[model samples]
Target chain A: MALTDRCDIFGSVHEKGINRIVRHLMRQRPSLFNYGTAFFLRNPNLLCERIQAAPEVLQAHDPLLSVQDPVPILGAAIPLGLNWCLQFTDLQIDFHPGNVFHLPNELGNLPAQRLALRMRGCFGLDCPSEEFIREILPQVEAEEVAQRGKEVFGTKERQPAAPEREPIVLPTRKLQCLCVELFAVLHFEWGTIPGNPQQWLKLRLDGLEIVDLGPAPLEEMAECYIRAVLKLGILPRLSVPIEAMVLNITELMRKQGLAIGETITLQPTPVPAGVPNNPAVEDDRLKAFINLVVEV
Target chain B: MAHFTLAVSEGTFRRSFDLLKRNLRFSKSDQASFGIFVAGYDVRAHLEGGTLDLRADNTISVRELDIRWDRLRFTLGINIPEICVGGGCINMPWPIPDICLPRVCVFSGNPDISISPDLAAFVAQEVSFTGRVVARYFDASVPPPLPDLCAPIRIEPLPDHNQWHIHIDPQTIDVDLFDFPDIVGNLIENTLSNAVRAIIPGGFVRDIILAIIGGIADFIRFLLDIPDEIDEWLSDLFNVSFGLLDFIGTLVLDFFSTCNPIYRIDDPFELLPASNGLIPVRIPLRNLSVRVNDAEMVAEVDIGG
Candidate 1:
């Protein structure tokens, strides 16, 4: 029951070949793997201080949670300082019989094929102290209060507010290094993407496992975050458009002045294990089967 | 081991061969003179019906491939010897002197009679060959040399590619001589006899002249210098005198080698298409080789950076 037994054509890319592609893509397109947010700090010390020092900690009004707001939180204009950043580099990939990262028992037991990825980077978050928040909040509230009064009274004349405070410089620690390793099982499905009529051989992330996260709860959270990133941000890039794989014999014949009105398409065929050259994740090779179909 | 390898099953190879066969065509016209008698042929033939075998020894064996004649016209030129009658000097008395009678000649001189008859439907040829599939890399950057215009026959041009050309390198080729039916001999004899008879007198005179000629068929066979079996003679006329066999062999060789390739693969194989203004991803191919097993023809290639 090997993959070749059920398929008319079979192909495989070895681990070395895969690694070569990964290296080229990672170097040329670094932005694909790196992400960061200014508010979400990677440094736990600063993040804790910002949360504890806030004045309205218990009754804080989150713009995101407001249902009846005039402007949506995403579209609303908000002024924020850039204080945190995360960047991943030195990304590496490996096919199963895992080498770079170990697969957990749950992931290892899965019947699906899998691959592991290891990446290392650094991130940092900066949060203002209690004194700085107290000083900044009142000035911001006073300016807002004056702006509201003018709008309520229907005044056309300009109104002068209190003098602006000088910019304050806060001391912060350097970014801390972080290493992440993840294992994901692979799944193959045939479907079409929205807005595109052509079919595609899609490679989907069946499952995700974050390796060595130290604690169970933290590992669970990290797994969820990484899964979302991989599923939404990365897997789509790997989906192969079936139209690209078609042999296009009709067009070639037309070029040669042959009027055979038949087209040959290279379609992926199902493969079962134990077949010679079976399409599977084994011996560090990702193999698949393809067959040619003629359409008139 | 290469980064990528593709194996085409024998069934698939046969499909490609069939396509090539469908498009294959060969037509030639040539004339040659053997002493006083001249022979010529205009032939148009095509390939059909062959058993394609992929051998484990890494060669392809094509057996009994029929070369079907679409149009085959054989032309023969025979120079009739002088035929004369009633020519002699009448003996006269010495004093009266000799008086001579004029010679009555059937023809003014040696006349060359030409006969062009279509023998295509009656004749056929079979060819067998064994060859290995060889892969040749074509570099598109370099221009190909100009063709030899002065040559008797010009070979078809090949693509100066960025392509992997798969050609059949023939090791051995066997082409059968053109086989003619027994009726072909009679057909030619009758045509020549009628042509000769047309110029002679009719009725009693014609019969006497034909009898003197000693059977028009025998007369023609003697003039053409042919054996008793007209079919065998005709076969030799076309095969050896006309050099049709040699022409066919060379044509077959050129057809399989340079004129057409069994398969072609682009050198820089495109794996992904350009999208959203991004350049297409292409991998360079190198060291492409082909081998045939009992079940399939395997082509192996290495990926270049």
Candidate 2:
């Protein structure tokens, strides 16, 4: 048989085992996936006027801003703010049935594998509100008019007084069952961590697809954001340090007082094809093959 | 299929076996006094030149592993019979005074001649056996029992923890009897003769003493109670009388099975080292088993969660 058909050392972990590991990562390292960003409105007049005519703009809705406070915009003089944050809690990962993680058949195509990850969690998002923008429109308009007056007449002018507006505090709207299905081709890299020569195995995001994100524009934006986070933030931390896997049999023997010169070096080898229950193609397990080299 | 599997080719296994053999050392001394003669030996031997064959039947055949004796000092002590003459008085010529002779002795008393000939590099034996590879689990939690002083071979127990010990369990051992060369018998005889000659007078007196004791070789042989072939006799003396054969066989068995394990793997085998305050990842090994084939030896194990 070919070397690719057999291995000196073989090891595999079941899908259940992978799920357990995922759960552990989620519990111990939650900061990897939970993040937020804010957007400040440059002009609040446009949105403020629209909210004032329609009070229902402040109500909770999907794919749109959800207002925490539904109070009417008494005066359009308050400055408006828009910010969004996503916090995921109780996150769980599932490798959908019949869709297993597996290595490509060709060795040249190695380091790349196909996998699908379906993540479900309690997702919370702090979205932009129309009422807050409407409340701050009058102040923004007065400031703009004064700026124009200064440019044309070159004189200081007093603006009309307006009622003070309370600062809008948008509450995070939480969804109990927010599901994200990711179909991606993952590539693996084996190298030492920078500044530390310990061997590590890391998986990189090569290609990604968001199965459903409503429309084309939304899907594209979601895919770009998720891909960036996975590539730059989460994937790098998913390394498995394998320095300990290279067992020094000679050293162990010497420690036991057996004087021997031969050393057993185990290095990761390509997972052989056509093996029964191949870890890569088999959805049930994740497996690895190692080549053993005895050095004198 | 097991969670983990490891296959070691025959060539690799031989390398490991050679290392183990090189590190193994056996040194022991014993003595026994049996009425007329006393015999003892202080020996040190090492294993070398073994043919290790992995068989298709899942057994290992070890043949001709020479037990090379580095030091083989055989000590013998024998009490020689005393020789005295000329002590009685003789009457002659009717009433003329009797003539009396003073006693002459070959030795002051019955001497016990002890001889330790240079028996250093000639004694050797071959040990052969067929065995199956077996694994034993050592549990560190339980306290070990007290040592058995009366056991055939006593091994000092070392503290072991949760480890899988792989041993070659011999089914039967066939150890060749120690074979001494003809020169060894001559060496012993010459030493004994020299020791006796050193204690006795030379010239006519020595001749007279020789005549009285019959041939010196005969006398020594009679004292040792051995047949004509001294080398065969000496071989028997070591192999049977002194129980060296049984001792060697038992020693080999105990050495491989109890004193040392061919291979050992610690339970909860550490796969990663602890760094940055994180605990090392260790996977517990379970149901470990080993088997031998014509091409290789294989070990299969499961990982405990």
Candidate 3:
């Protein structure tokens, strides 16, 4: 109906991300009507969490079984941010905390694939006792709901905490366990691509310029960092109402030829070990790099 | 004018390219390949010089030049249309190197004016290509090198909603990871080095370290942290330690690419993201995307009298 435009709403139903909230308000009479007008006024943060968790509440359709979730909102937020990047001619965002992740209120970058997102530990603001979790939990689908929450959050808890990242020799805290001297770390560069049937994963932890909290399993320690970075952090997603033009620094590096072909990539020599045999990459020729760099 | 003719498809850009790809040794900077043919010329005369030209200029322009004595020659080139001033075949290696080269000169008028005393040379060139190049002559004349029929860059492209995911082969990974000793050594060395010397001032380090160690034990992680290359750093610091040259030389043939696979992407506009999780997408560029940078190459030889 409108003239040709540079922007388009993805669909009518998902209007700039407010439809879901509108539906939530319709169900529970405005806190002004039921809980008391003053109740909604008491806690602004609580009110926001409720509004954000509306879609989760409406879809599950079980009020007595109420729970607060921040995952999908985080996921949705990612696409929205990425869309913002798309609208710009040059979008440059550093791979830093808050800029790229939404961590739990506390704890980050844990090694486990299943994580809890809340101010307190495992459960959200109001968690059932361990006893209740044990009794009513196994009987129902809370685990399933919990998992859905995890994917939305785009990260998991750090199980097994401090991962002995390397066969390190201890400097201070010595673990008699055969864990060599090392630091615990988790690489956030993990991603799943669509249409890849084989579903193979190439693990890389190099080039992060990672911080060392000292000798532990890097996988576990990395979680702490991820959590730190992702805490209430912005999740990377693809959304519209804006644009989805995420300027991946890595891809840019690849474009600038900073992403050199791995020696194995070229030779495909097939290291019996499987890691691409990366011959030392000559740093980008200063001349070539300078010529193409308008602004990085 | 001496002329040679080579047949190509009606619009045979790909075929002509395939022929070049199959026939030469690669050069890095200019992305060209060089191959040679003596051409029924009498090399028996050593008193005069000769010129190298693509008699078939309308059809083929020289991309690489190979000039050598009895038998020491190096050449690899390509014919990128942007740089081809097709009619400049006045002399072999003309307007180039500005030296007495072993090549025959072609004068739109008379051919003998340009002269050199000790020269015997050959001419070779290539052309631009499209589609799947079906190589007709990649012979043993070139040294054995790695092959990549499928391009690897542009493996991960994020188009609107859909993304290009370059998948790695797990089997290939497992075999490659466990088999290479240097890689394993690198891992073990880094791990071992990292395992030691961590100071936990108070419970912070101890607790965090223990927790991190637990996570690593639980998560099954792989991290390769090679210390920053200090050779250049050290060299820079010392200045005399080869850093002064700051020279990074690559082989005549180099593979400056990675393992990520390349494919096209479709904009999976999110409005109707798969409720069932199956989304439809189209590969934008059905054909592969490859980048080869071979511009101009220079060889240096100084004779001081």
Candidate 4:
């Protein structure tokens, strides 16, 4: 092993003895030994040496040699000369035992469920308490704005002093037929009849009475009920006929000269009864979770 | 004085942080009642290159943040039988290349790092990051520029351990794309207004007026193209930034919140030797201050609390 280590075959593997034997074999039997001599002359060890010399080719095969993936190699080779902020003498932070609030061991295994739901074009408002104002109203407003944009480009109220008396209007045709579904889930913790928990909820859209799913029964023990249905009078029908109907309505009001680019609002409102004037959301025992969704 | 402080090198942090990679995929199928049907959606993002650096003044810098998306693919079906609009589903897939946000630097600028001792944790100072974020939709040649992001991280220490557990509160990363409407409108007006007028061939005053109004409609439609699913996806994707800010911000908090034991000193409760042959002592740590250098930080504290 020591002799093998000392005898270094640096670049070309064609040693003196090996080269002499290969030449003698080729000369003795020209046709038969020519291929064998050539194979021996083009040694695999020499090929390896050549590959080691050409780093780009080697890197193409082995990502460890490539610059794009140098983390594995550089991480081991280079030290991370991190200059810390604190000195060796003053690195300690005061550990105040009183700072930590230890929870009871019984509560450690409390079942906490986690759910991730991805909803599209649905506005959800969640608050620690009911006192937190309608936080999801802004989302509703944004939805309203998006619906309004679909109707027209925008109203351009030209100045009175300008040559044109009327504003520049860009009118758009609504989708031929469409139906929207409004869904809501209510979780009532209390304030309802225990045997038969029933409640009335009303929903309105675009100044049109959508639906009032009269009275729905709730489950027991923090009862949760899901109530979903088509909007009230505007059933799933041909939107072309609906458009013509709207046009007839517009014709009746034509004397007023229904201006172009006028916005048609689609506002959604939910009213759930059986709660105090202002439900105290902070009271965990008397809490309710209401989630509203509008699918168009 | 009972004190202990530990110093973790940048290499040590990198070695410890080598296990944060996973495949993320999402698919959703929605058939809306409003003449819109999406058969299926496949969104994939593969995180490739990642490197971390612990900077001075409690800052963590990531040099390479590359995310390669397989494709933003979906099949859209619009069902409106009336007005010659029949119901049919077409495969609409987006071919988006990789997005690399290089050298994303995040640091705590605010000096007020609030500590909730009751929770055994500290709310990291409002962490801010500098990185160029872009959100491009299918068929959109140019993506929208994202605003800078800033947020806070809650960092807590683990008992009997030298490391601190860092949690990213996603609610804190605030990036608003409310100006998208304004941007789209401006783009349409600038690029289309003159072109529309040129094509209309109207020299008369009345004709010119008609041309202007007609052109605005075309511009609005082009601007509001792909409003439903693709627009929402781009907006949501950009809004989250692949949780890069959250991940890197947590690293910064972890580095800053680490209570390493550099030196451990015993604390004697009393001034004299105790009856059990133990000295009663206390280490008074006082006058704590931290100063930042270009690439280094120097902290000084007295032996008195």
| Alpha carbon lDDT of each predicted model | 0.59, 0.55, 0.25, 0.28
lDDT of 3 by residue, B1-305 (tens): 00111111121223223332333232222122223211111222111111112121121222212221232233322322232223332334745653443444333322212222322222211111111111111222454335542244334332334333322111100011121222343344446436643543455666666566555533332222111123423432343223222222111001212233233223221222222222321112111122111211111111111
Candidate 1 versus truth, CA RMSD in Å, comes to 17.8
lDDT, model 3: 0.25
Looking at model 3 chain A, which ten-residue stretch has the lowest summed lDDT? Answer: A284-293
In terms of TM-score, the best-performing candidate is: 1
Q: Candidate 1 on B1-305: residue-level lDDT in tens? A: 55555666666567656755776677889988777677999999887777788887788877657677888998888766667886688889878877787888764433277888997666766565667889988788876556633233324354555988788776555565553322343356556557658986478777776565546544553444333234324433343222355446745675546546778888776665544433444556778888877777666676664
True contacts kept of 4: 0.00
Kindly list the per-residue Cα lDDT of model 3 for residues A1-296, writing each as its tens digit.
21001111111111112222222332322221122112223332332123332343335432311222212212221211100000001111112122223333223543322211111111112222456435543534554666668768866563345443222111111111111112122222223556643322232322222223245576457655654454334333321111122223335446655432221011111122322221111111000000011121
Among the candidates, what TM-score does chain A have in each? 0.56, 0.47, 0.16, 0.11
Ranking by DockQ: 2, 1, 3, 4
lDDT by residue (tens digit), candidate 4, A50-96: 11122322333321111111111122112211110100110111111
Kindly give the stretch of ten consecutive residues in candidate 3 chain B with the minimal lDDT sum. B168-177
Judge candidate 1 at residue A200 and give its lDDT: 74
Listed models, DockQ each: 0.07, 0.08, 0.01, 0.00
Q: Give a tens-digit lDDT track for model 2, residues A117-139.
A: 54432333334446744665576
Q: Write the per-residue lDDT of candidate 2 for residues B1-305, one digit (tens) a residue.
A: 55445566676567656766776778889878777577888888778777788887788777557677778888888755667898899888987988999999764432267788755555666565667888888798976666734244424344466888887776545565553322243345556556658888588876666554445544553444333234334433343222456446756675657646778788867664544433444556788998888877777777664
